[model samples]
Each structure stands twice: as structure tokens, then as C-alpha cells.
Target: MWLKRFGGGCSREKLRSILETPDGELIIVGGKSHGNNQYKCTFEFYDDAWILKVDADNGAKIWEKTYGGRNYEHFEDIVKNPNGGYYAIGTACNKKNPPWGGDYCAKNKSALWMKFDDSGNSLGKKHFTNGPNQTGFSITNTSSGGTAWVGESKKLVGSKWQYKAIFYKLTGTKVNYSKVVDLGGWNATSIELTKDGGFIIAAGKNVFKTDSDMKIPALEK
Candidate 1:
């Protein structure tokens, strides 16, 4: 394996996904400074997801977008849309001293999804959580003018953590949401829609199948 290094003063932290822009620019999607730090004072250093556009010709920074609060955040994947826009996916924590809906996630973690134009202006966002804890890792643009996000949902089933695969489809601009399709058990690692209007999803136990109606079932154990 060959490792090509970018000769620059690089910031250290947890790095995630990367995408290529239509104008031949390199878009790097990852997190900011992470790990243990002292003198910086008191708690674990939180990392936020960032988008850095590098000029392919000179390997120089063109622009960057950091998405997060003082808490932890990270982007798992990014997709370029047909309309010269981009989508970024990740997870975040709820820092509210008093959260809405009296949900457990008010004290736990939640998923985050964001979309932006080529110029780095945010278009909108989609967040998913079952009140207490949830997270999304993969995202894809749909042919039907929307997008899909895949991830795992963690909920307190009695006293144990129940892991379930989740898929959310975004439909409108006025805050309309798609039905949260539950894939029963197992963790969904990634999801991709096919040209035939079906979906292929890889989870921990097996590869599942979802029809155009978005009803998915595990094909194997």
C-alpha cells in the first residue's frame, strides 16, 4: 500500500469520508481535533465534522465547512447531487439542559444530516433519534428528488440496549418526513438505491432487500 501525504500543516483529529466535486476539486469530509487533552482544561476534546475543498491542481485549501457545536460530531459519508449540491451525514449529542419532548436523547446522542450547495451554503438538515439515542452513518441522493439516510437506532428496551437498523427518506422542504422504516434487528452499515427502484442495504447479520415501496427485510441471517 502506498500512502500519499499532503504537505501542509495538518490538524490532528478523527478523519472520516472524502468526496470529489464536479469542478475537479477534492472535498474532504471529516472531524476536528479529538482525543485527550490537558491544560486545554477539563473534558475530552470534542470533534466536529468539516468539509475542506482542495484545489486538485495545486493541492491547496479552497474552502472549508465545520458543522457542529462544542460537543462531539463526525461525518461518515458525503454524496454529490445532480444539481451541483452536496450532502453530509453524521451524528451529534443533545446538550440541552432541558430537552424537548422529555426524550432521553435530551441527555443522550442523536443523528445528524445536512445538505449544502457547491459554494458551501447550507440548504437544510435532517435529524433522527428515538428520544434517547440514535445515529446515522451513510447517505445517498435519490432519483425521486429526495435523499436517504441509513444508520442504527439505539433504544432502551427494558434495561438493555436494542440495536435496530433505520432508514429515513426526506420528501419535502417544509419539514415533511418520511416514515421511519425499521429493519427489525441488526445494525445497518450502509445503504444504496438501485436504478430499478429498489434498495440494497448491508447490515451486521446480512444483506437486506427493500422494494420501491421501501419495505425492507433481511435476506439472510
Candidate 2:
């Protein structure tokens, strides 16, 4: 067993996720604050989302990068794609002009997705925001060179604010299937592609399965 440290020089960095690449390297994703941002928070950086590739054997930094110009952006989940790129989901507070092509945000927070090549280059980005406090927590690879993410969406359900679990399937940055589950779970924290052509998701206190289209009975609540 070995332990290694990253981020230095008076900067505050917090790691959010890590994945092993096909080539046995490590891809670490998190947020970095160059020091002192809006909140005047001292313990951590909440300015930009950070990603880096490092040697798995000895933890030598190969490449490192930080995205999100100024607003608050933090990656909550990440997954390695079959086509050699990486997909990440952000629980972001990017209200205005985001890099992913979204213009309006009903609230201070929104859900985000971004793709990065093996060399850590931005490939594409997408955001899902229907109401207030939208957040995506997990991203997983499904069949057919596609990816999926699970998150929370706050919307009005019959004059009452409800927290819905949102599932989105993407085919190369294009949303092909989406489902808003109003099961009162608050947030979907994890997701996996099942072997039987289905999906399993874990939200606040709910676990359910859905077909490839994210439709049907939701198997079990």
C-alpha cells in the first residue's frame, strides 16, 4: 500500500473522485481554489473543478488541469468511457453563461456534465436544470458508447416543492433518454448499468431499477 499527496503552494484542493484508467494510471477529480474566493472559506477551494492524471505506481503527476473560470464548480462523480474519454458530473453554482451552453438557471445551483479526453482536454459539456438546487452525483457507462448520470432535481409538483431523482442517458453528449422520478428520495447518489439491460439507482432512501429507456415500474422502491 502507498499514499501520495497532491496540490501544494498555498492552494487549497479537495479531491472528490478517483478512477483507475485502462492503462493503470489514476485520474483524480476535485475542486481547487487558488486561495480566498467568494465565501471567504479558508479550509478548501470551491472555485474550479480540477482533474489530473498521475502514475499509479508512484503517484507522480503526469498532467493536471482546472476548469470553470470563476463561479463555483465542483465535480461530484466521474467515470471512464469505453471510447477512452472521461465523463464527469458537477453539482455546480454556475448561474450565468456556463461553458456547456446553458443560459438561464432558475436557482443558484444546477447539474452539469463534461467530457474530457485522455490528455485532459475538454471535449464537451452539458447541464440539466429544471428548477432550483439541481445536482448530479453519479456518472456511469452504459452500452453503445453512451453514459448515464443520476442526480437530484427540485421542481414544483402540484403546488409543493419536491425533490426528484433525475436519470439522464447520454449518447456522446446528447441526451437520448431522461426520467424524472418523483419518489421523494431527494437525491440519486449512485447508478449502475445492469447485465440484464437495465439500470439500478440508489437515491436518498430508495433503490430501484429501470429498463434501458428508464421507464416502467421502477422494479422496487
Candidate 3:
């Protein structure tokens, strides 16, 4: 057995998700600092979402890709598309706060989804904003050749702040369904494609079963 390492000249780096392609290649996605090696104790750091394609046998790096703006972009989850490509979900933050107001810029985070070709080239990208801040946690390929993802968001309700889970379905660049469901203020951690052409969302102590249309028809504790 052997160990392999990959990174830039940054002080911090992390790998969030890993997937094996149909041909046995490995794809890893995460975030890494784009700044210099100068270590800082504060939270002020510039980073970019990083994607790497490696040979499964020898762990050799085939290609690398980074996505970001002048701010930070952290990728949390990635899935291999059926069409010989990939889909990644995460959060993208810039210098400007969200237009919804109410301290959205306090964190400057928004839901981000990006599509990449087999060669690690970006095909398209989308930013989703349901409230002040939203961050995608998981993404899965749908049975209809589309994609579905779930995340957490903070919204204002009755002069108070409330947390909710947001779900979205996309087909090629079109949004099929976008729903915000309140799950008792618990963060929706992960989502999976069920065998019955549906989805199961795991949040805190509850599991939500949604139909093909992503409607919560049953909730399990």
C-alpha cells in the first residue's frame, strides 16, 4: 500500500467528496486556499473549489480544475452524471451580500451548482438563492437523466429567523422543481436516490421520503 498527496502552495486544503467513474477513474472535489503559503490565524482566506481526476490504479493525477471568483467557493458534493460528465454542488461567496438583506453578507454564501465535462472543463454553472444564505450538501443523479440536490438555508419568518431545507431538481440547465421545506430547524445533511424512483432526505433524526416529483409524502422518525 502507498499514500498519495495532492495540493497547491496553500496553507489549508480539504477533500470533501470522491467518486469513481464508470471506467474506474477517480474524481475528487473539495476546496483549497488560493492564497499564498502565509499562514493566518484569522478566518480571512481566499479559496477556490478544486476538482481532480486521478487514475484509480496508481493514483496519478490526470487533470485538475479550480473554480472561484474574487471570493471563496467551497465544493461539498459531487456526482458522476450518466452522460459521461460530472455535477458538483457547493457554496459560492463574493464580496457583495445577498440582495435579500438581513445579514446575508455576514457569511456571503450562496448555493452553487456546476457541470463539468469528462475532461474537467466547465460546461455551465448556476447560483441558487432561496434566502439569506444557502449551502448545498448533497447531489444525486435522477432517474430521468436530471439531477437533484438538497441544502440548508436561513429565511425570515414572522420577524424571526428560521432554518429550512431546500430541494432542487434540474434537467440540463432548466429547473424542474425548487422547494423549501421546514424540517424543524435541523440541517438536511444528505440525500439519496431511492429504488422506487424517489428520494430520501436525511435530516437530524428524521427521514423524509419524497415521490418522483420530490414532494414529501411520508416522514419517518
lDDT of 1 by residue, 1-221 (tens): 23334312235554567777898888877666432233222122255667778887777778877776655666777888777788888787755442322342333777778888897777887666755666777877766766777787777778777777776766533223333335566767787888977677787767766775556543222
Name the candidate, 2 or 3, with the larger lDDT value: 3
lDDT of 2 at 135: 80
Clashing pairs in 3: none
Residue range 89-161, candidate 3, lDDT tens digits: 9888744523422432445568889999998899999888877778899999898999999988886668877
Question: Candidate 2: deviation at residue 156, Å?
Answer: 10
TM-score of each: 0.76, 0.81, 0.84
Of candidate 1, the 10-residue stretch with the lowest lDDT total is: 36-45
- Which parts of model 2 have CA positions greater than 4 angstroms off? 8-12, 36-45, 97-106, 155-162, 218-221
- List, residue by residue over 152-201, the lDDT tens digit for candidate 2: 88865587777788888888777888777777547788998898767888
Better structure of 1 and 2 per TM-score: 2
In model 1, residue pairs whose N, Cα or C atoms come closer than 3 Å (at least 3 residues apart or on different chains), thus clashing, are 105-131, 105-132
